[model samples]
Target: MLQMAGIAVAGSCLSPTYASKSRLLVSIPAQLHREFTPPLPAFISLNQRRREVLPSKSLQTALIRCFDTNKAASAESEENAKPNKVYFARDAIVDAAARIAPAVANLYARKGGQEEEGEMGSGTVIHEDGYILTCSHLFFNKMDVTYAADEEIIVCTQDKEIGHVVDAYVDLDIAIIKIDSPSSPLSTAKVGSSSKLRPGDWAVAMGSPLSLQHTVTLGIISCVHRKSYELRREGMAMEFLQTDCAINPGNSGGPLCNVDGELVGVNVETMKAHKASGVSFAVPVDLISAIIKPFQSCQMPVQPYFGWVMRNVRKENLEALKQYYPTFPNALEGVFVQKVIKGSPADRAGIQAGDVVVDFDLQQIRNIKEMMDVMVKRSGTPVDVIVERLMLGKNRLVHLTITFEEKDVAAPRPRL
Candidate 1:
């Protein structure tokens, strides 16, 4: 017997006969049971009355089983929801350099048949038949003078070969040299688009820095469309793609490649002398593509002569111009014409020194570099230009028609 709530309960409730079924039994004193008993509703059945008076073992067991099942399902769900492990390869730069390595070669230029010392630089093979592209300044002296026609340029690849300057564009500082055909087909770099490049993209420069051949340096692009004037390199109308890759003297004319091993630019200049690290410049592949055909055909690329010295409108320059003109537009956004050559296209079109070129050939002109690029494509064609000129202390828009004239650029004699 067991004592519960001042009532004696029979321990036989745990017996096999009662435990085998879903029933429980309890024994209580007669006086207490009658005192605690309450009247049941008429709708309650006999079994319901029994259930209200005694606990049901089947109901308790069912509740415990349901809770255990829910807990186990939740644990399994959490285990399956965990993320999976991933893997990555970190040899992208190494792979990229290896892809374009075969096309890169070391170039040595000798003048007057002197084998003691000569100009040394790097070059990229652009054609499988042995045409190499390099910087024109590589063959020039400190005075910015070209070498004699009889100078010898030796190309060192897997094997030594004689090279000759086929053609050169001095203004852009680009030269193409052709080497004697090798016994096997030469590897050419896969050319990529420079116009698609953006700042912060991976830039890999492969060249010979300080006579170190087949050297590769890695960095990121710093700027695209860097104008020549911004670098204080006047008379060059083209723009450069600036990178933070380490480029040295011998690195000039080497290939600037992307992560996919495609050539995007030709390495040209670096700011190592200024004690700056990772500051370099390259000629954009678009400009290289533009001159490749002409160079191969033994013709010099024609430049359009607009015959005007211009500057991009900037806050500092505009402020300075306002002090003199007093009527210059304060919010002007265009290329400012500083001087117009006499009898030139701009002069004949009524463009004056103080005019701001707002539009050209139906396209808006924002900077001098952009204007130059457009002029190059539309050379030898008639186009309309809109300028903002101050008239009676007020800004007036004037539209004029002008035809671009092709400037005569002499091509170097090709030695086949």
Candidate 2:
């Protein structure tokens, strides 16, 4: 063995307990001849004169192995040190916001002969002829009053266009304001299918949260068809698109867009932020047609009656369902019909309360909202409903065409 500069050149490997972990010189090679040169310390010369010596074949072989190992390690370190590239949809956000921002109208209301302009909510232009969609709560304080000709209603557009209410839902928190004779052409956002939304899809929320004009925030769709009662404890029985996007007081009635610069939902409410964080909900874009369709014929905006109260089958509810219906299938997915109204479409069609709805009108039913979306437009139309019912202690599939009833009911209100 040879020793120099506190290094041990031994024939055998040293224990890791006593080895210097910071440096690998002692671990790399076993032998060092007079020609051996350290990377550092300049290999201090004896008497200030350098001596020439030839290295043995074994020493050269060991040096070669050490060089190969170091080369491989350096390559690995370089790979690890390389920075990663992060991709963002900056152009998508900018374009989508441009299309949606023009339709957004900041609202201010004067109630009960008050002269001051009170902050209301946000609105989106659904029609090119100046039809703006907004929340119904924006027009009323304590008593719900119709926007009369004598009352003062202000709708300030992104391009400084003034508008007023043309149509409003009596029950639901949805209304339409119209911009009369605008200075320029209105920019209407393209409406996308909310039925296509999936969990973790990119979601962009543009609204005046806290009255901050045209504020935009980006997030993912945390969930789809989230029930209103789950978040608010007690409120309207409605489905919403739950997201992590921040929604504040004045963000109501604003647009919730997708990555394709299309409107997917309407920003309605923020979750209990005092208890939860990054939780908010939006009304699905399908509801916009639900609020507008009935009024097209100069009739009252009545909710399309499905005559069945159902809940999405989740893991937590599976156990409860098993206790009630012992023969319920363990692999069943979709909606669990909780109640069937007597003499209604579901009840007359032989759909029981415990039956699990798997498909509606040939389309697979994944959630409660999917079924609602189908029934909302087909109020009087007969559609096939496929359900799984337990009969004779076995699961059986039942198919029936049920015609929905059209009844005068208030539109669904936003709960949370």
Candidate 3:
């Protein structure tokens, strides 16, 4: 027997002996309609019956089992219901931005007791003792004298504080400023590993864009290994983490964070012509960490110098080169040495112009970027380089070992 919404059902094929027993009182909720009701058994019949019905004990037990199953199913469906993906992503971005907001600071370059509008920039506090990291170019004047003789760097945290330029690496365009926050420890951002990053990962940029403090922008990692030379920034041997996050002039030196609010890169420059195209670049935190580690001991990091101009091997460029040297190698991939500085490491190693670099430090060199990446890591060490050259009207592989000379940007000074 089954009952639902004032309707009673009973099995018609029940034995006469069981039907002669006392009627079973089965009751169901009056509000339950066909939509909420479960399917009835095939042997049951729905008809206008009294409030009580006669049914076998086995049939009564089956009806109770069906109701229990439906109840459990409805509960599971409600439990599985979840919010949209957009809401989850929104919360992630909000939490990430809030985590790093306290460590970001606005920087101002003041000259003649007035703050220069164009000299505004951003920085991230990397130490609890008020050590801020920012771009060195922010303090450069037309004459490029670090900071002008009369200009001062004013760091604005929760309150205004005078900042002193403790160290500056012009080659990498990184600067370290110190502020005296002895009364309280400043908030510092947690650094993350940029080498583990991949394309399409979430990126968050926090800084003061257009002098608006605490600005945050959400974007994805456009690329992980964008070479500096590819962006027309010559002589820089580092690669950047390219992102679509909006980084304006004032956003430079700010922290570029991941979805978990860890600092992965330092916001650097954006394509001026493509400002609306969402093309921006950040210096990978790995390189920044290497450069700043020596600063803690009041020492400057070593800058590796490789005096050679090179480019990737393209068909058009190779054809142009073959016009001059008809015996140039017709290789599909290799770094083409265009010019070697006189008396430099390449020149000293017998590497001449028109040479195609095949391998360096036991690693194949496919482009100038790869060569630069390897050279930066193996600084102040001797490495074997293999190049293909036309010798006596025949292609010959020449092996040479070159040692890189590391130079310091400035002398170490006592900490401020």
lDDT for predicted candidate 3 compared with the true structure: 0.68
Worst 10 residues of 3 by lDDT: 141-150
Q: Which tens-of-lDDT digit does each residue in 1-416 have in candidate 3?
A: 22532333243124445434644333333334533766444333233342222223224332322222223234454345342333245489999998899889899877677777754889998766677888766753312312232246678777787665554444456666767333466787877889989999999999888899889999999999998888877443678999999888799989999999998998988988543479999988887664444323322232222345455565545565677656567676787665555545566678887788899899998765566567566644677999988888878889998764333323222122
Give candidate 3 misplaced runs (Cα > 4 Å): 1-89, 141-150, 180-183, 274-276, 293-416
**Could you tell me how far off, in angstroms, the CA of residue 359 lies in candidate 3 after the best superposition?**
26
What is the alpha-carbon lDDT for the whole of candidate 2? 0.62
- Residue 297's lDDT within candidate 1 is 31
Put down candidate 1 lDDT per residue, 1-416, tens digits, no spaces: 22463332353443657544634444345545766766443222245324323112213322322222223234455344433333224798989999889989888776666543533788888766677888867754312221333466778777877776654544466667777456566787878889999999899998888778899999999999898888877443578999999888889989999988888998988975667777799999887564443223323233233445455565545666666555466445787665555555566678887888889888887765566466556545677999898888778989998864343534332342
In order, the Cα lDDT scores of the candidates are 0.68, 0.62, 0.68
Query: Model 1 segments beyond 4 Å from truth?
Result: 1-88, 114-119, 141-149, 293-416
TM-score of 3: 0.51
Per-candidate Cα RMSD to the true structure, in Å, reads: 17.9, 15.4, 13.2
Error of 1 at 290 (Å): 1.9
Roughly what TM-score does model 2 have, to 2 decimal places?
A: 0.50
Ranking by TM-score: 1, 3, 2
Model 1, C-alpha of 61: deviation from truth (Å): 46
